[model samples]
Target: MSITAQLTDSVKLPNGAELVNGFAFEGRGDAARRALFHNGHELEVYDLYEVFSGERAPAVVFPVPWTGWDRGVDSVSPDATFAVFSGQRAVRAVGSDGKQLWEYRHGCWGPELGHPHTGDEQEVCRGLEHGSCRVSDDGRLVWAHVVHGADEYDWQEYWVVLDARDGHELARLPLGSAASGSHHVSHPDGLHMGLCIGMGQDGILLHWARWDGKSLTSWDVNEGLDRILMDVHNGLEGFLTVEHDGADLRLHALDGAVLAEGEPESGDDENPAGWDHCGGFVDTETIIASTVDSEEEPDRARHWILDARTLRVRGGISYPTGPIASYARPLGDGTWLTYDTRNGTLDRWTTATP
Candidate 1:
C-alpha cells in the first residue's frame, strides 16, 4: 500500500512576513476555508485557495501591541474580525482595525515577580517561558493557558476560557503543573479543545477540555504516558499522539483508548526510528509523518504515509521537485505543506496519482 506525493503549488511568503506557526489553516474544505499568518505584531488572514494561487493580498490584517518574542502563541477568530495574543503577562484581543478590543490580565510568565516596577513591555521581553491561545470554532470563546497569581506568594498555571466578545473570564481550571509552553488543538466538534503542555525535562502533559456553552469541563488524558497530542482525526473518531521521545506513535479514541500503535524500524536493531511532532492526518484515512529527528543529516530525513486507522507505514512520499525540508505539515485536505527556508517559499503537495 504505497502512495506517491507530488508538488502542486509553491508560494513565497509575502513581503518578508515571518510567521510563528508558518500558516494556520482553519477548516478542511471550501465551506470554511481560510489561513492565518502571524508574525508577532501583525496577523494577516488569507483565503486558503488564494494562497495556493500565489495571491499576496491578505483579506484582513490585525495589528497587535506586543512584539513577537514577548508572546507565547496567538490566534485569530474564525471570522477574521478579532485576533487574540497570549503574551507573557496577559491575553489580549485586538480588532481588525488595529484597536484593542479587550485584555485579560494574569500573572507574568517571566521570572520577575512581586513588585510592580513600571508596566513596561520590556519587563518581560525576550522571556523564553510562555503559554498559548486559540479561538473557538464558533468564535464565541477564547481558550487560553496562563500563569495566575494564586495569592501574593504563589503562582499557579491555569487554563482559562474567556468570552471572546469582551474578554470576560468565564471559566478556569488549575493545571497544577510547571509549563515551559503549550499549544491548543481544537477538536472538530467545536466544543472540545485538546491542550498539550510541554514541561521540559519533566516530560509532557496532555489535557482535554470541553466548553458546553454553560460550563467548562476538563480531564487529563494520556496519564502516566509522556505523549505529545498531535492532531484530532478529521472525522473526530480518534486523535493522534507520538511519544515525547518520538519512540512510538499511537491513535486513541475519544475516551482515551489506544486503538493502534506504531514503532517504525530505524534500520538499527537497537534504535527504532520515531515519528517527529511535525505531521498530522492528511485526510480521513491517511496520515503523513516525518522522522527527521532520528536523522543526523536533514537531507537524509524521510516522510512516510501511514494508514490513519492502524498506524501502518504505507510508503514514503516521493518528491518530484527534489528534496523537501525535514518537516511536513498535513493540512487534512489531502494535501501537506513544506517550507523552503532558502527562498522563504511554501510548497504545497498532493498525490500525483490517486
Candidate 2:
C-alpha cells in the first residue's frame, strides 16, 4: 500500500507552548472540536478546539494541576467534560471548570522516599519516571499504572482500573514493578490497553491488558526482548519499536512476536545518528516513520510511510522543517499531522480519503 498525504491545513498554537508528542480529539461527531494538547509540561483541553478545521479561537482552556517536582499520567476524557491528572502522590479528576471532582491517593514519587540515583529525589523523578493515567473510550473507566514507591530498591506497580464516573477503585493488580513510570497506549476496543517501560540497564518491559468482563487480564511480553516501544500501531494493540539504542525499527504483536523489522535506508559506512526516534501508525495499514536530524543531515529528518501489515515502506511524505523535533502524527482519515515549532504552526497532510 502506497500512502500519499498532502498538506491541507495548518493552525498556530494559541499558547505558543510546544506540543507533547501529539494532540487528542475528544467528543463525537460535530462536537469533536474539543482537542487535548500537551504543552510539554501539562495537558490542556480547549473548547471548540479542532486546530485542523476552520479558524475558531479556543473558547476556554482547562489546565491540569501539575507538581513542579513530579510527572503525572496526563490526559482528558473523550467527551472533553472531565480531565484526569495522575500525579506523583494521587490521581485527581477535574472538571472543565478546573475544579477537582475527586482524588485517589495512589503512590509517592521515589525522591520523597529519600533515595539517591542519577539525580536528587526531586530531580530524579523529574519527568514521568513514575506512573501515568488514561480514561476509557465511553468515559466510564480509568486505567492507571499506579506506582507504589517502597524504597530505592523495591518500587511496585499496581495495574489499576478505576471508575471514571465517581473516581472509585474498580480493581488493582500488582504488576511487580521493574521501573516506576511506564507510558500507556489506549486501544479503541475500550477493554484493552498497553504499557511500555524502558529501564536503562535492566532492559525493556512490554505489557498488554484486557478486561474480560469479570477481571483485568494482562500480558508482560518482555521475555527475550531488547527494544522499547517507539509507537503503537494504529490498530490499537500491536507496536512499532526500535531496539534499545539501535536503529532497527520493528513491528510487533501484542504477545511479543516480531511481525516485521528493518531500518531506514541509509548509505554504507554511514553512521546514521538513528531516527529522530518518532513516527506511528497512520491507520490500520500505514506507519509514519521518521528520522531525527543526523550529524550528516542536521537540516531535516526524513519521513517515510510504512505498510502496517507488511511493515514495508510505502512512500515518503514531506513537511517543512521544525525547530524542536520533526514528527508525523496521523489523524486516521488518510491524513497525518505535523507541528513545525520553528514557525509555531500545526499542519495537516492528507491523501484523498479512501
Candidate 3:
C-alpha cells in the first residue's frame, strides 16, 4: 500500500514534523531521535537530541542504505547504544550521535515449500531467525529469537542472548520444540524475561524465564490461546494480554490470570479477524481496537476505545474514507499518536473531556 497522512485531533507538532515508529527506542529520552525511511533507497536518522537535550545540533543527519521493508531498533546500554536489525543482519550504532560501531550477519536459508520462497533469498534465507530484538533493562544484555531452520519438514527455534558492549554471542535456548511461531517480546523486569510466540497456524504461546547475564531459566505459561495481544507495563510488574476468538475480545493478565474479558459493544465486524493488528493496549485501563465491515455496501474501518477494567466500549469513530494501519500510543501528555503506514504519515489526536 502507499503511504498517506490524515489529521484526526487537535494535536500538532512544533513544526508539524511527522514521527514514525513511535517507540523506536525504549526510553523516553531516546524517543526524540527520529528515524525515517524514504522510498526504498535511503534511510535517514535525525537527531532530535537538541529538542529534548537542549544542546546545539552537531551533525544530526546520518544516512544508511534502505532495505525496502520495515526495520526494528532496540536500545542497549541504557539508551547509550542501539541495535538495528533489518533483513538478516544486526548493526550496533551509538545512540548519542548515530555512529556505526559494529555489525553482525546471520546467513540465510534456501527455498522449500510450505516455506514457499519470497524470491529475496537474503530476507527469506534467515529461515525464521530473529524477526525482532530487545535490550535488557540494565543495558548489559541483548536478546532475540533465532529460528535455526524450519523447512516444510522440520521446526526448530531458539532464543539468542548477546553481550551489548561488543558483538559477543552469549546463549541460545531451544524453544518452540512444542510450538512454532515468528514473533517474540522480552519484558525486562528483575531477573526474568517474558516471551510471546506468535503461531501462524496454531495459537500463541507465552513463557517467562530468568536471565542471569549468561544462562536462561526454563519457560512457563498458564494459558495457550490464539490471536494473542500483549503489552508490558513500564514497571514490568505485570502485562496485559488480549485475544479475539472470532466473536468476543478477551483480556487477561500475565501468569495466565484472567483479569477481565468481554465483547466489543460496537465495531466488531462479522469477520472479526483483523482485531489483533488494529488493537493494542494504550494503558493499563484503556485499549484501542478497530474493525471493518466488509459485508456492507462499501467496506470501511472503524476505531473503538474501550475501558480495560470494565471491558466495555467507551467511544468510537468511523473512518469512511481512509484505512488505518496501526493504533495510537498514549503520549502521557493527554494526546495520542497513530502511525498510518498506508499513507506513510503519523497523525496526532486528543481525547474529549468527559
Top of the candidates by TM-score = 1
The residue-by-residue lDDT of candidate 1 on 195-286, one tens digit each, is 88998999999989987878888888756889988887557578999998888899998767899998764546554566777778888888
Candidate 3 lDDT for residue 185: 43
Q: Ranking by TM-score, best first?
A: 1, 2, 3
Off by over 4 Å in 1: 14-23, 29-33, 113-115, 150-153, 294-296
* Candidate 2 TM-score to native: 0.80
How many backbone clashes does every candidate have?
0, 6, 7
Model 2 pairs in collision: 6-350, 73-133, 130-181, 275-292, 276-291, 276-292
Over 4 Å off in model 3, which ranges?
A: 1-80, 86-130, 149-155, 177-193, 218-223, 244-250, 267-274, 293-299, 317-326, 329-334, 339-345
Task: Give candidate 3's whole-model lDDT.
Answer: 0.48
**TM-scores for all candidates?**
0.91, 0.80, 0.65
lDDT of 1 at 48: 65
- What does candidate 3's lDDT look like per residue over 154-247, in tens digits? 6455666767767577777776533333334445344556666665566666666666765666555644555454555443255555553434
lDDT of each: 0.78, 0.63, 0.48
lDDT of 2 by residue, 125-229 (tens): 444466777787677888877766556455677878888878788788787456645667766555677777656687777788887657878887767776666
lDDT of 3 at 228: 53
Worst 10-residue lDDT window, candidate 3: 9-18
